[model samples]
Every structure is written in structure tokens, then in C-alpha cells.
Target: MLQDTFNLMPLWAFVAACGVTLVAGFVKGAIGFAMPLVMISGLSIFLDPLVAVAGIVLPIVMSNLLQVMRFSWAEARAALREFWRYIAVICVMILIAAQFVTMIPTQTFYLVLGVPVVILSLIQLVGVRFHISPAWRRPSEWIVGLISGTIGGLTGTWGPPTVLYLIALDTPKAKQMLVQGVVYGLGSVTLFLGHLQSGVLNGVTAPWSAALLIPAFLGMRLGFWMSDRMNPVLFRRATLVVLVVAGVNLVRRGLMG
Candidate 1:
């Protein structure tokens, strides 16, 4: 099964993909986010897009599980309670939108997805006071969750928007991390199921994803160790900066393509 897929790549390219997985894992461990962004972007540099997507699934799901485990059940339940509507919108929308991935125009899809990520990350990095008023919060949750779940369904990335939402709320840092985990955890589950239906993750690709888990987990451990020494504010600012840069790259590719 792995032969028809992973064996298509040169041995060294596969090794490099492992390295990329490690780096992506470290980023996630340190920041509690960005693993999917990093994994997909980095792995795509050397592998086919569908292959790259499949490769990251198990690792990302496992990473989010690790994150969810960090919080007690009470904390997880509280996060679910607070963000339930957004979660519902995101989940339902993802299921519906994901089934249509093959029909969406690729370049337009990328632009639609990338532009918002770029804009939101730039606003946050610039220290702008972007906030959602309580009056609009419920409506905004549905709207944002709709957009987020759609992107996640079609592209397997739903992080930036969710991050923007949490940041806008000025959620406490620890709580924010837990919320991210919960949101991402749910999104990842949907992504896994959606892709299974879409045929992106199958018996052949399963081993490749499973094989990549080693480097991802190892890198996460290293990152967790280093995260203790970094300032929280600094880490978040850095994450935003990286997100902006990534968004810009995505936008550029969408335009150029």
C-alpha cells in the first residue's frame, strides 16, 4: 500500500519530509497552534498536495489529542460550553462543505481562504484593538464559524480564523490555548472523516501518515521543553507574525496560480 504512494518519492525527499514534520511538531508544541499550517506548507514543498495533506492528518489529530489531554475534563467542558455555537456551525458547515471540495475552483478557493488569514493576522500583529461586541457576538460566531468550517472542510485549515476569534475576545492565555485545542480537536475530527469520504485518506495513505508520527511527536517533546523558557507574550506575537507571513505566501500563490 505504501509502495504505490510514498515510494514514488526519492528516499532523501521522504527524509526531508520527516524533518519538516519534526519542525512542524515543535512549532505546535511551543505555541499550541500552527501544526497544520506548518505541516501542510512545509511538506507540500516536496510532496504532492494530496500526499502532503494525508501525511499530516494522524500527526495533527494526535497533537490535538495531546493538547486536549492537558486540560482537565472540567476545563474542556467549559470550553465546549462557551464556544458551542461556533463549534456547531463549524462542524455542520465543515461536513457539508467538505463534500464539495472537488467542485470548487482551486485558485479562487485559495484566494478566498488566504486573504482572510492574511488580513486577520496582520490586524492582530499590529496590535490593533479588534473586538467583537457582545451584541454581535452570537451572529459573528455563526458567520465566522461558517467561514472557518468551510475552509477547514475544503482545505483542512481552520486555525487562523478561530485564532482571530479567540484573540478578539481577549480570552485569557491558558484558556485560549485550551479553546484552540478544543476547536482544533473538533475540526481535526471532522477533517479526518471528511477526507475519508473524499478519498484523501485511505488504506494506502494510512501508513504514510502513521510513519510520519514519530518525528512529529519527537519534535513536540523538544518544543514543550523549550516553551517553558519563552515569554507568553513573545510567543503569541511571534506566532502572529509567522501567520501573517504564511498568509501572504498563500495569497501570492493564489494570485500567481
Candidate 2:
């Protein structure tokens, strides 16, 4: 049955993935987060994790590049300087973790991702309040960077930890979004190179990546349009719920596997 299902995947699967990409992109564009989470979770339902990751890489890179480009060079440079150590650690860890991708079992992947989603969701849902001390922010930045990079390399979903850490910093929304875009843009480039080195960038994944751009662009446009109208509190709450559900589903899938 599994083999039959795999063999039977048709154009509709691609279409569905594209649709999800649109939604994910819109969310990212509008709010500056959730694209990776939304896209990877949604896409993983229809395709293998590796294919989903590959499909997302180009669109995310493009989207983030456009976002970061909107910022002035001075601002971008300042932000990069502030976070350079963190970024450096993340890049190095991502490269190292990428080497071990082939060693991760599918079930293990699901569990590793699933457990975190649940915990993060519950924290948000319950309104857990914890702040990183100013004195510790520098070191914490490095820690978050390492975590994000490692997870990103392994699962192709790397935004949550960085997002959480940035949120803790109390940065203005615009700055937060810009910094995320720039950081992710850098990470995406590194990730793409890593995948290429691992030989995961093949014709099959390449076409899928191209096809995904349409929906991704659509989503980004929608998200941009909706950004101002949406309430931040509501959006965060909804995202947490989605995370919880996705986490549970992934855990279940892992257990079954």
C-alpha cells in the first residue's frame, strides 16, 4: 500500500504542495515567520522530507533576499554586526549537521521535530513568560544560532529557535522581520551548498523547486496584503495551535514508522 501510494502520486500532489507554498509564503511575508514551519509540515504530508526541503530552499532564499534588500545597507550591516557571532556558529553547525543527514532515520526525524513543536506550542499557548537577560543575549544568540543551524541542516526547518530568541530581544517588528530575512537568506545559501555537496540537488528536486515558486510567491503576496490587518496576538495564538497539531501528527507518524 505504501509503495502503491508513492507510485500513485500525481499532478495533484504537486498542485497541493504549491498551494501550501502559497499560504506559507504569504504568512512569512506578512508576519516574517512561519514559512519554514508551515511549508515543511504541509509538504511533508505529501512528499518525502528531503524533497520538501529542496523545494522550499529556492523560494525561501528568494523571498528572504527581497525582504532583506528592502532594508538600508547601514541597517543591514548593523544588524549583522550585532549577530555575527551567532550567525557564524549557526553556519558552521549547519555544515557539520548536513554531513550527517543520511544517517538520520525517518522516524527519528519525525520525533525530533514533533517533540519540539509540542513544547513550543504549549509554552506559547500557556503564555509562559521568560526573557533572556541583556547580559546573556550575546551568548544566547550563539546558542540559538547553533540550535537553529543544526536543526535546519537536519530537518530543513530552522526558524523556530531563532524566532523565539529574536522575539525575546524585543526588537521592533520591522527590524525583527528584516533580521530574520537576512539571517535566513545567509543560512539558505549555506544550506543549498550543503545539499549540493550531499548530492540531494538532483533533477527531480530541481523541477519541484521550480514548480513551487508560483505558490510561494502567491502566498507571500497574500501575506503581505494581510499583514497590517491581522492582529499579532491572534496570529501567534493560531500559529501555536497549528504547531501543536503538526507536532502531534509528526510524533504519531514517527511512532507508527
Candidate 3:
């Protein structure tokens, strides 16, 4: 089945892709986000860019469902209600932007996805926190949602912008995790559908995506266990460092490609 799906890709490359998903899942479980970023950056090193995007779809959807289930259905519903505007904008923008995915140059897509991730991750690492006043929250949500959705549609990674918006809001840690799960859960569904329309998730790629769910699930489960035993502050910083390195690697690939 795997060979039929990724006939052009070597067995080693397929194994490596599974490893990437495992690590991505671990990071998401530990720090509450970044699975797509890690998967995109790592898989693109070995797979076609569109294939990398498609490969993440199933794992992301499944991981997010697990994350959301960690909390109650009531909490998920409440989050959806509170952030409906942002969510709605993101869904619409993802559908619109996804149509152009096939038109973007691979190098341009890499730079577009990598540059912001590197810049934003560095800013957070350097202790620069964004602040949004109560009056500006509405507008900020719309703006960020649009940006996040567009980037997400293009690259299959939208956690950074969403995380930034949540940080600026000064959301409590517990609430932040729940909100991330809720937002990303819905966004993942849209991503799947958008790419389906774009032909990124057709018969050939869908099997590869589905196969990756195994490692992603295992890694995330282990990560959840580890997270309970580790210090969150330290884990988050470590995750950010990994993001910086992965982002830098993507930029390098773009420049060198």
C-alpha cells in the first residue's frame, strides 16, 4: 500500500517521514502546538512540497481531535462560540486561498512559510511579547485570522499566528490550550477540505497521510505522559528552539532550491 502510494519515494524517505511526524506529534503534545510546522519543514526536506502538506493533513486532524478531547465538549463549544468570528474568517479565507496553492512556486512557498516562523519564534524567544488592548482585540482577531488562514492555506501551518494572537490576549494557560485545540481542530477540517479541492489529498497521497497517523498518535501519547512529568516553561522554550532551527532549515532549502 505504501509503495503504491509513494512509488517514487524511497523506503528510507518514507521511514524518515514517519520519524518527522513522530517528533512533530511529540512537540504538539508537549507544548500544545506546532505539529504542522515541524511536519512541513521536515517532510519537505525529503518529499515534494505539496506531498508534505498532504502528509500532514490526517495526522493534524487526528492529533487535534485528541487535543480537543482532553478537555470537555462543553469547553470546546464555549471556545467555538467565543472565537466564532476569528474561526469563520479563517475558514472562509482558507477556502479562498487554497485555490492558489498549485500556482505558487515551491521556493516562494518555502520562504513565505519559513520567514514568518523564524521571525515570530525568535521574537518570542527574545522576550518580546505582543500586547492587544481590549478595544483592539476585535480588529486584531480579524487581521490575525486572515493572515493565519492565508498562510495556512498556502503552507499547511498556521499555529504561529494563532499562538501570537492568543499570547497578545493574555489568555490563561489552561484556556489557551483549549482554544488552540478548538481553533486548530476546525482549521484542520477546513484544510483537509481545501486541499481536497486543490487535489493535494487525492488517492495517491491520502494513504501516506493516513499511514502517518500511527506514529503521530504514538509520539503524542508519549509526549502527553512526559509533559505531565516535566516543567512546562522549559518544554515550551525547547519547542521554540526546535521551531527556530526548523524554520531556518526551511529558509535554507528555499534559498538553495
Candidate 4:
């Protein structure tokens, strides 16, 4: 099945996608976010958008799982308890949204995915301080979680919304990675299962998605290595800059297409 899917693509394109996945993994490892955004944006360049999405689903799940495992069980449980409400929102909404993957138009998908990413990244880059009083935090989580899940389902990218929500809460750097892993890890589990039920991850796409895991893991190791050595502030800013660029490109494609 995998051979049949790959056979449809030029050899060069497949090789290129593997490289793209590696870079995506590296970015995820360094930053603890944006893997899905990077994978979909890069792979969508050559592969059919739907196939591009399916290919990255497994990688997202694997990387996120590894992320949580980096922390101990007690830490993981604590993060989950803290963010459980938002996680619930993401899980339920993502499954609901996943059913509509093929139902939405491609142009609309791009627009929906790109616009929020650009806005969120720009907001962060500007250094706006969001003092979320305890009053509005719960409601905000639901709203953001819904948006993230819907976008995740439609375009296979949900990191931006989640990131914005966490930053707004002023979550510290280390906790941020753990929470992101827990939150996104849970979502990835749902995403994988949701897509399976929705017919998005069948015989053909399954093989392709699994195959991309090689580069994803390799790139993530390199990124994890760099994360230990690099300045967090600088690397985070770099991630935002990349997000801005990728988001703008997506917006352009949506408008042009």
C-alpha cells in the first residue's frame, strides 16, 4: 500500500518530503511546538494537501508522546490535571471536527489555518502582556481549545492556538513544554484515532505516514540536542518568526488558490 502511494510520486518529491519531515521534527524538538504546522506547510508544497496531512499525523503523535515521557509520571499527571479542562475541549472538539476534514473546501481550510497562526504569532512577537485574571481563564480555555481542535481537524495544524493560550497564562518555559506535550499528546491520540475512523488513515496513507517517522525522530534528536545548548529566549523568538513566515505563505496560497 505504501509502495503504491509512493509510486505515484516522483522519487525526488518523496525524498524531499523526508527531508522536510526531518526539519519539522528538529523544529518541534527545539521549541516543543509547531511540528504539525511545519509538517503540513512543508509537505503541502508537493503532495496533495490531504495526503500531506495524513503523513504528519503519526509523527505528531510519536513526538508528543516522547515529549511527555521526558518528564516523570507525576509531572505528566500534574500537567494533565492543571490543563484537564482545556484538554477535554480539545479532545471532544477535535473528534467532532475531524469528521469534516474532506467536507471543507481546500481554500477555506488554508484560510482558516493560516489566519489565526499569523495573528497569534504576531501578537507574541509584539510582546503584549496578557494578564488573564482567574475569572476569564476557564472560558478562554474552552474557546481557544475549540478553535484549536477545529483547525487541527481541518488542516492538521493546531499548535498556534494552543501556544497562544499557554503564553497568555504566562506558563514558564519548562512547564510549557510539559503542558504542551500533555495537551498535544492527548490531542494527537485523538487525531490518530479520529482520522482512522474518518477514513483519512487507511491502507495507503498509513504506510506513508509511518515511513515519515524515521526523519521525524532523527530531526527531533538533533533539535533536542540543540535545545539543551541554545538560549530559550532566542530559539523561541526564532520559532515565532518561522511561524509568521509560514502563516503568511499559507494565507497567500489560500487567497491565490
> Against the correct fold, how does model 3 do in TM-score?
0.97
Write the residue-wise lDDT of candidate 3 on 1-257 in tens digits.
55669694788998999999999999889888999998998998888888898899999999999999999999999999999999988888888888798898999888988898898889878878889999998998899999999998888888989988999999998999999999999999999999999998888899989999999999899888888999988888888898899889889878998
**lDDT (0 to 1) per candidate:** 0.81, 0.78, 0.90, 0.86
Q: What is the lDDT of residue 7 in candidate 1?
A: 72
Q: Candidate 4 on 1-257: residue-level lDDT in tens?
A: 66777675788988999999999999999989889888887777677777888898899999998888899999999998888999999899889888898786787777777888788888878887676778999999888888888888877777877877888888998999999999989999999989998888889888889989999999989989999999977987888898788888888988998
Candidate 4 Cα misplacement greater than 4 A, ranges: none
lDDT of 3 at 212: 96
Instruction: Report per-prediction Cα RMSD to one decimal.
Output: 2.1, 3.4, 1.3, 1.3
**Which scores greater on TM-score, model 2 or model 4?**
4
- Residues 1-257, candidate 2: write the lDDT tens digits: 34433443477887788788888898787778778778877887878777776778788877777678878989889889888888887877877887777677888878877787677668768887668889998889778888888888887667777777876887778888888887888887888788777756555566667667778877887877787889977887887788788888888888997
Give the residue spans of candidate 2 off by over 4 A: 1-9
**Superposition error at 107 for model 3 (Å):** 1.0
Ranking by TM-score: 3, 4, 2, 1
Clashes of 3: 0
TM-score, model 4 to reference = 0.95
RMSD of 1: 2.1
Question: Which has the higher TM-score value, candidate number 3 or candidate number 4?
Answer: 3
What C-alpha lDDT, on a 0 to 100 scale, does residue 147 get in candidate 3?
95
Candidate 2: pairs in clash: 22-219, 25-220, 26-219, 26-220
